[model samples]
Target: MDVDYVEYEDYTPDNESDNNITTELPFGSSQPSLSHVLVAINILISVIGLGGNSLVIWICLWKMKRTVITTWYLSVAVSDFLFCAFLPLEVFYMMTSHWPFGLVLCKVTSSALFLNMYSYVFLLVLISVDRCVMISFPVWSHNHRTVGKALGVVVLVWVLSALLTLPSLIFRQTTVRGSVTQCYTSYMGPSKHKAVVLTRFICGFLIPFLVIVFCSSVLCVKLRRLTIKSTKPYKVMAALILSFFICWVPYHSFVLSESDLKNHSVEVLETGLKVGTTLAAANSFISPVLYVFIGNDFKKILKRSLTSRIEEAMAEDFRTVGLNHSKSKSMEIVKS
Candidate 1:
């Protein structure tokens, strides 16, 4: 369940027959070179992603007033925040090549990682649909877009994500071999393992990917027909979708390739898996950059601290008076 690339060592228990073989790793030589590099990458990701995602959650959920898009983003931030929370354990596992936290943590951390990924993609789909609705039927969206409904959908997505993560939890285990501790998914058979990977690729990646693409296409057509000048919102959505695709597609593709897991050598698969996982993990931190660049208000709010935003909120009357003075001056100039 931990983010790991394990090379299992086969052993047969003294009390067991030859047929009762077990796959385990002995406390032998550690892969210090690879472990050091992976540990460094994870530490970097944890520090940046945890901070960026926390800021996003704070801004969208608390600092800014709730809107449909903000509510959707709030869900994403929550998932990323939870994902970041477990990074220390992953880092520890990578550095030492052992699972010290025991079996339950192994299952929970693995399940949480996949759960967050699924939840993230599902939220993106919802955001795309919301945008498509806004563009295609502005009147209906104006009347029907409610925070309560958006929150309800968020709750449903969480439920779905948890359900999807259950298989990983069920399959995950902690195996010890000669003082070496390992956390891994010990599928009953290769068939079962392949099935799980296929399921994840389809449910967690393919379906949501298709939905986002379809929504984007429809939204583009509607905007083109309407002759809209402001495409900032669409641009923001596109950035989000593109980032998600870039970050996740490689991971999913590598996973799907694992259906033929026997063909891959341990060293080769480990390297590829590590690279894919690093890319996938990058999404948590990169998203905040996209938000700042593509979201109109995100940069403005981030530029100022919480106290500054509160002060601005308190000085609403002063800002309104200034705006009125500017308007009056412009009117007089026009008349002259």
Candidate 2:
């Protein structure tokens, strides 16, 4: 999402004046009904995301053993949980179109949004690559993959994501426009704005998406070659990757298109962006739901506790992969 601002024409600060700056809102305030609808949807997303991600965090941290898979799941859950935690501020801003939170909270909230964006996608990429490596070189992966190394990688992802989010912190500011106060990004010029948008589209969406697709493709080919009969693990992974692509592509597309102001109507673009962002936000909770449904049998999930079902799903996927690898290895030994 772009900086948190209200719907209004762009303004530029005077060279000699310190107070004026250009701004735009995440959603338009022209339609009070739309704002209300957005507020309702965002509140719902926040509630579901908070509950779902919290459950995943608790299950991953306490119920499951500390393994690479669990580490990735825990890290992703934490990222989503933090994002959902900060959503109320956005909900407030959207409902009132007034930012009384001051500049620091403004920056923090915006930064958290992107932090969740980058960290979540990067973690997904890591998971996909890890799965591929596990399939391709089971012995090496078994020996080299460790919870400690996974933690290091997760920390690195967070650090890189934070670095990418600095622009949001640097540009976000709170300013009073008459009776209303707005928090928005003041990029000062089109060049700077274009650069930020392009960076987000490329790093936050394009590259990570390509990598995930490649890894998924490779995994599919490898699994077919191995003649693996159980498709549950693949199904779960496919649902995750597909859901991410569905949720994020619209947001990125609308944002990237907004960069070219002449080609698109401002109102249309803004509306599209709001809708896209809602879809993107939906991704945070969707992962946990996917874990429940795609990861396990529905009947069994109904009988088991939520945590037990999730744990079983995680362990079941890992066990399936190991079993497939063992079978392949045994076949090779027999041939030898």
Candidate 3:
């Protein structure tokens, strides 16, 4: 029941044997170099993404009046912003190229990533369900979808996501392979590592992914069957769902099925994982563009912002011209 990558490709383990292995990624030869590159991108994404998602949260909570629709979007904005904020610590590991942060942070940071990613997924599912409910029972939904209840749901989602991600916290370890250090979950023993990884893949990506797809499909069908043409909100919702599918499906796909379970050759899997990781960050940007930027109020604010800048520039230009004219007249008098 050896759980080595070479063994995972061909051997089948008994139930007891499956749980015997570890997930702590062994450090690699190029650990420091890889960490530097990953750290740079992680920090860059966190800074830019944190600012953008903050604007989203600001617009939803303070600028735009909150309705049930806006409430759901605001919830999603907060989730994305939270992910962006804590993401810098992930780069901390990358900066050191080793998880010098120790067992506690290794567990916390990776667990937080899983929590945020799943929290976002479940929120999207909630939004789809809320839309369906509104369409089917607008009056009832209006009576019940209060801000307090929305807050409660968000709290529950985070709690549940954190619980699901707790194992990473519990088992997260910094491992060394030769000189390279990597932050990842470690199994208790070698015999069960592959099994643990496979299970994690299913739980982390597959089940919730299937749920999202099913719920979204049902939602689209319900909307399409309506007796009237879809309105602006529905169109926007559709666009948001489409963006979610495009941006995230490949990421999960790349994660769950990227490599053979027992193959020690993580080179291919790691390469694919990096691509998915980058794509996942991109999703933090797309949702706001699809949902917020297209709003009438958003457009008006953008236009006003642009206008203000233009006005300031014109005033500065006038002042410059006046100064030049005055200086020229003085020179002419002096010459005469």
lDDT of 1: 0.74
* Cα error, candidate 1, residue 220 (Å): 1.6
True-structure RMSD, every candidate? 7.1, 10.4, 9.1
Tens digit per residue, CA lDDT, model 3, 19-119: 44444232222444654564566676688678767777777775667776777777777767776776776655544545555666666666655666667
Q: Distance (Å) between predicted and true CA of 5, model 2?
A: 3.4
Q: What tens digits encode model 1's per-residue C-alpha lDDT throughout 161-219? A: 99989987887777675786777655655566667778888988899989998998998
Residue-level lDDT tens digits of model 2 in 1-336? 352343233643232143334467545545657767777888998999999888778767755567898788788889989989989898888777788988899899877778888998899899899999999999999999999999999999999999999988998777777777777778766677778888988999899989998998999889888966677766867787788889889887877787776788877877777778878888888878877777654324333455454555555576677766645544444343
- Considering TM-score, where higher is better, how would the candidates rank from best to worst? 2, 1, 3
Model 2 misplacement above 4 A: 1-9, 12-21, 297-336
Model 3: lDDT to the true structure: 0.59
The TM-score of predicted model 1 comes to 0.83
lDDT measured at residue 124 in model 1 versus the true structure, 0 to 100: 92
- Model 3 misplaced regions, further than 4 Å: 1-41, 175-182, 189-211, 221-230, 263-265, 295-297, 301-336
